[model samples]
Target: MSRLVEATTAEPANPEPVFLDFSSVQVATASYLRESVLAFRDLVRGRRSTFYPVIANANDDVRDELKELMRLRGDVLMVCTLGPAGDVNMARLIGDLDPKQRMTFDLVHEHGETDAGELMRAYGESEGLKHTTAWNNRLAALAARGLLMEVSQGRAKRYRPLFEDA
Candidate 1:
């Protein structure tokens, strides 16, 4: 785990998606996955690290292990397929996202980029969100989980989908 963390530390110091490709791995134990993948994500994101890690090309067995681990942890991660040009061809979330977070994620995905106040006005009534604070908390939570990219515009923070077409 420490070695994996150390290896990732040498990544370029710029904000970008870091793909952790697992095309060769046929199997991975839950404890190993948790210690390496999950721990690396937590440590990097906790430090406000520049790179966002995305799992790629994981086989069914590895994916299953990760899904179970994430379900137990109540956290989520992005799993994606890279295109020939190294673009995200498709992406999905693993683990479980509560209804509210899922809703927030869908809203951001559909709208492109938005802020809490905007969501409050557009979805507050229909979504049972009465105040901007509620929307803000949801967006903040998604950002913390590495599902959304949080950007600052003056005093207000806006969030957008980390993947263009996830």
Candidate 2:
């Protein structure tokens, strides 16, 4: 575990995307994964980056365990898997998301940008969901968690991706 920290902090000033390459190794108990990967991610989250894994190769059991951990982290964290053709694809984070936040992230990811009013207006007329105050709280929380980038737009704010490719 401490070795993981050392490898991560090698370029602590501005660490590039770190990947715990799980290609050779085989068996990994859940506790082992949580202690190693999740703990490292939390430590990195406080500093320069989030713990994003790229599963180069792993067997069925190991893959299942890792997938469960990723799901627990939710959209705030992302992982990748190498395809047969060597293409990098974002792994599906299997978890429940608050409806508003799911929409917020989807909009920003799809449209490349969005604001609270835009979300409010869209949801308001489309679904009759008028909850601007709730939107404020939700967006603020997401920004603070580093999931979305909050930009002040004079009297308002716009949300963008923190690490997502736009």
Candidate 3:
């Protein structure tokens, strides 16, 4: 576990998604998953590294266990299928998000790339978020959860889905 965790720690020069491929092998217990997968995520996130971890091609049993564990922990992870050329073919989120966060995530996914002001203008009245701050908070939360990638634009920040098609 330590060795695997260590391998994931090396920081990349530019921001890039790191797929933890689970193409084969059998079942993984929650305890093992928690100690290894979750631990690796925490370590990378803690360091504020650019290595975004995505659970790729996990089997049903493994996905089930991870979903249950993430739900219990109130966290989320990007899950996806990668094409032969290593592009994200299909993507979805595992675990959970609050209603507002989920709504905000949906908006971002639909828009491709957006900022707080745009979200407020588009959804504020309908969603009861009259202020950009409210929308910004939601965007920040999504980025913190690793669901979105934040890019700085002048004095503002714009967010996009971590996986291209997510």
Candidate 4:
């Protein structure tokens, strides 16, 4: 007979989280970069939660600068957006990570109306990517993440920002 070992340990408490959204970094100058880094450090050092700073389009120069800043401080996650729009290609990246991820960016826009078929076609033309189905899938994933809003449904589905009213 073997005795089961049961060691008692107290679970760790949750910490406060922080979220930062940056739509564009190309406009941020060197001073802005320094200030932002300081702000991030102050916000994250005493917390035991996640910190996400969204930097869109950070071109080669911006990316290099930020990378250097990030190296000095190990508290931020830099999400580099690739494809037609920044961060919109998250689905494709996810697809690369996990094959099980769904591809759902189908839906077309005509006269301000959205249709599944048309949307897929437009996505292909706009991005010059071969996978319309994958684009649709990625769009759907973006919707799920609150980055997009579905405007219409059925044969056509239109989407806009959740912040449109604002």
TM-score of each model, paired residue for residue: 0.88, 0.59, 0.86, 0.30
Best candidate (score: TM-score)? 1
Compose the digit string of candidate 1's lDDT tens values, residues 1-166: 6766777776564456778888888999988888788788878778766667789988889889889989888889999988778878778999889999898999999999999999999989997867798899999888777788777677988888878778
Report, for all candidates in order, the number of backbone clashes.
0, 0, 0, 15
Error of 3 at 72 (Å): 1.7
Q: lDDT per residue, candidate 3, 1-166, as tens digits?
A: 5875677667676567788888984788999888877887777766667777788888899999999998899888888988789978679988888898998898898999899999888878887866899988998887766788877667888988886567
> What's the best-to-worst order under TM-score?
1, 3, 2, 4
Q: What are the per-residue Cα lDDT tens digits for candidate 2 across 1-166?
A: 7987876554433223455667677888778877876677667655535333333455667767766766775634444565678555554333445787777667777766677777778676675667777667777766544456566557787767644552
Against the reference, the lDDT scores of all candidates come to: 0.84, 0.60, 0.82, 0.39
Instruction: Give the alpha carbon lDDT tens digit for every residue of 75-145 in model 4.
Output: 23334344553224332111121322222322221223343455557555665567556655754554443
Instruction: Give the poorly placed runs of model 3, Cα more than 4 Å off.
Output: 1-10
Misplaced by over 4 Å in model 2 are: 10-16, 48-58, 67-77, 83-87, 113-166
What does the lDDT come to for candidate 4?
0.39
Give the least accurate 10-residue stretch of model 1, judged by summed lDDT.
Answer: 7-16
